[model samples]
Target: RITESQNGWCWQGPVEVVWSNPPAQAGSPRVPAVGLHSTTALLQVTVEDFEVVCKGLYRALRIREKYMQQSLQRFPRTPSQYLRAIEGEVWRASDTGPGTFKHLEGFPLCLAEDLGYHVQMKDGVVYIYGDKAAADRNEPKDLPYPSLERFMDDMNFLLALIAQGPVKTYAHRRLKFLSSKFQVHEMLNEMEEIKELKNNPHRDFYNCRKVDTHIHAAACMNQKHLLRFIKKSYCLDADRVVYDAKGKQLTLKQLFQQLNLHPYDLTVDSLDVHAGRQTFQRFDKFNDKYNPVGASELRDLYLKTENAIGGEYFATIIKEVGSDLEDAKYQHAEPRLSIYGRSAEEWPKLASWFSEHRVYSSNMKWMIQVPRIYDVFRSKNFLPHFGKMLENIFVPVFEATVNPRAHKELSVFLRHITGFDSVDDESKHSGHMFSTKSPKPEQWTSEKNPSYTYYVYYMYANILVLNNLRRSGTLLATQTLLGRKRSPVLQYLYFLAQIPIAMSPLSNNSLFLEYAKNPLPDFHQKGLMVSLSTDDPMQFHYTKVQCELMPSCCPSLGLGLRGPRFSGKPADAGPPLGQPLEQRGLCRQKPLAANTACGCRSR
Candidate 1:
């Protein structure tokens, strides 16, 4: 009886079969004639007898082929399916292979097939096996499989396709499958061997190009697991800098920190050396002889050296540090000092000195830096007197520089500092009078009236004072001192006041026109002026003359010409008529006189 093998072949019935008296031979028989017997009994057969037995053999093959194909219908063509179908053959032949055969090795033939093994039928079973040695011999040396040298490269290629973070379930399953095929523990050991080989100074592993695979493997894997693996298998030296694709050294310190690993040998010496190298690169003048300090150390140094430096020098340091200067220990310095001195007592003195010095010199740069000082003052409530001094001192200097363009900016600055509408009240001060109704130019020229220079100075002083008050957040006091009284006419007056400045050549023509049309007495006007002033002037280079006089030409015939023409009649006029009464002859009331003249003409 033929026993069917798991490999889908039956081989127990007979080793050979013969057929007798088939069809005549087409070609000449061999020196010894051979023929097939009709009966299925051939103890021995030679290659020459195949033709004589061809018909019966062919019939048997057709029957077997039909049977095998029908049996194969239940088996899938997938590697796993084929392996399962052929598992019996592999198990039966396990004793015959070169390797020591165990009854059940549980060798995961499924993975073996996936790795490109072939399945074949032998005896009464299917066999799933591969000749790894043969496969390796056939492949180019550069393309060896299960190779430690290529592992990292393969891992890197896989990693490039994955997004960052945890591995997907599908990928984990695949890894598990791969792990079953090869001895994972042995593979890991091999990886270590490769690492050691690369690190061997005598071997010139760099020339072999093996180290890159390790790096790629480490980077591509789950960072946590990769780090653990690296720590276990390789001696990762923190001092040894690794270059990335960009050619910049990937700081292992940062990577370790990101992984939350307290890296071995991460000492202060290492950090200092790294910092020194970085600093030297940045500032070529930086000397490496003096070891670079950390941020905390530098802060401490600043505090110690602050007193040694004069207030101006200290101020320079503060400006350099800006908001980054946050050492609570050094809070007792003079708040008004040019460099963020925090002492309330020193502010008035600093302010006084600044005011005195400013009068003799025009230092726009120094003036610009004063805002930072104000910020320091705000942080530490130095003194009310100091705040008052700032108002009295700096605002005037800032305002005095104003042309019509600067005046608008100064107005905006005042509004920003005071938190008061720049043009809210127009009755109290000429500073708010930007209207066509402003006092005529002749008024300032008269002896009784203030000179143009005097008014200019007054305007400058008011702007300075108001800005200081605004900076202090004393909006009420600022308004009391500088805000004009509100009036309906003042709205138009304010509109008019802005016209001259708005039309001045120095003003932003488009911006001024925008303001003139919108006429938001509080917000947009101040905002526009402030925006224009602080931004670069080169962008909107309006001449001062145009800004000063454009309002005066409005409401005139020429101005109205751009507006709609008045189509209605005069208010006192009667209804319109097509003809006059005189043309209608209704005024010829002397009828008798008219008749007499006609009779005389007839005679």
Candidate 2:
């Protein structure tokens, strides 16, 4: 006999049920799909509160999908399909077929002829017009121009949602469920995965391409590597004029004499670039580590890009790092170069440096990192206002995109550049909260620094517009932030959006948090799309294999041999969106068949 009940999907003996809708292609070889096959609603909260949470989450995902599509960035179709189904809309898969790029002599530099578009910056965002007439009429081209007011409204909603008691509790419980679910799955399938991995041929941890998603170009080399480079540079360019002290050019030897130091006497300990106990929870102390032997003169002479020798030494060191990655055959890195918005000319100077040095490596991509030191720049009277600083950071790139031929070097430089990063001390609290009531960027002329969210919103707004214009997408990935205690709503949102997070546990251990305190494992278990990164090898690492050391040392290194396998996952470590598309395969093999749970080719 059958009895009606409030609970759903109870099994009857020897009974079978078929779904009306067929399951989508799994895209991998047949493996037993593990899932919670339940129809009963597991509501931990009141029905009203649960409904509120669901609505908030749906709206949040929609907001992300809207922005991603507007900027031509990638958003996984799985969520989109679910969202569409909820809205009773059909979801069609769009094919972004194999794209191509033009390279000049092995560099991803595409020097297009020209596209005569009038570009101007307003409210800290670049606007493109067809001609002067269009500008006069206040009509810009048909691009996805970001609305600051709308952004502020959305931001405010999210800020409030995260603070809501119901949402927070619901998100915390959900995250806990995901973590427990992942642990159970791991325990049951661990042995089977290992067996599959052993039977697979020609694949192992060493052979897998591991990409260090976040690393600083200035500090890309470790202490020993930097020490070696310093001594070698001193040996080769001792008599070369490498420093300009108020117009008095000093040779490398003379510079060493002025700093009261000898290259021969400098050991890694003496170089003193590594972060130690003193640097823990001290950003200032960590920054001081950029200078060798505690000398800014040495930092300028060696690490800076716009310095006395046109950053020749810096370029050489980066090239050396790239060569090392190339030699390793399966390693890659995206090294960030700083663009302090002291002047718009910084771009041209940097582009010139890049061109003159021919600092191109097949395994290396470049990123431009803007330091949130506008207060420092403004305090020195270097910049008029926050808008000018933003202009210095982004305007030149807009001009290059508008007329590539006019700004050929920067245009080419932009090709090599994959993304932008905002670097700042997160622990420093700001008094201002970003909202519509807050001052516009131009009006933000106070010496006080803006909040982190303020900086991120403006940068994201500009990048959003710029990506639309360039039609070549760039993703914004947060490093070292996700591995900290964050707002539950924000954390859940990150998981839903699958935002790529590059975590540097060792780096965090030295600067902000201890190794045991890092949230990498929790974030990964909750499916936050986390990856391992070596933030600053020079400051945090002792070995030459910097990136490899991070995954190897971390205790909760997810996959056995690969550690954080997400380190090389395409969502986090793929080639730049502008690069020529290779095969649409995650694994480097041809015809990319679906893989087993062990990441081995399924036979």
lDDT of 2: 0.65
The TM-score, computed over Cα atoms with residue i paired to residue i, of candidate 1 is 0.16
Best by lDDT: 2
Query: Candidate 1: lDDT over CA atoms?
Result: 0.23
Give me the candidate number with maximum TM-score. 2
CA lDDT, every model vs. true structure? 0.23, 0.65
The digit string of per-residue lDDT tens for model 2 on 114-150 reads: 6677888888777889888889999997766557687
TM-score of each: 0.16, 0.84
Stretches of model 2 off by over 4 angstroms after superposition: 1-34, 38-43, 95-110, 473-486, 537-603
Q: What is every candidate's alpha-carbon RMSD to the true fold?
A: 49.1, 7.9
Error of 1 at 322 (Å): 24
Q: Which ten residues in a row have the lowest lDDT in candidate 2?
A: 589-598
| Shift in Å, residue 414, candidate 1 | 19
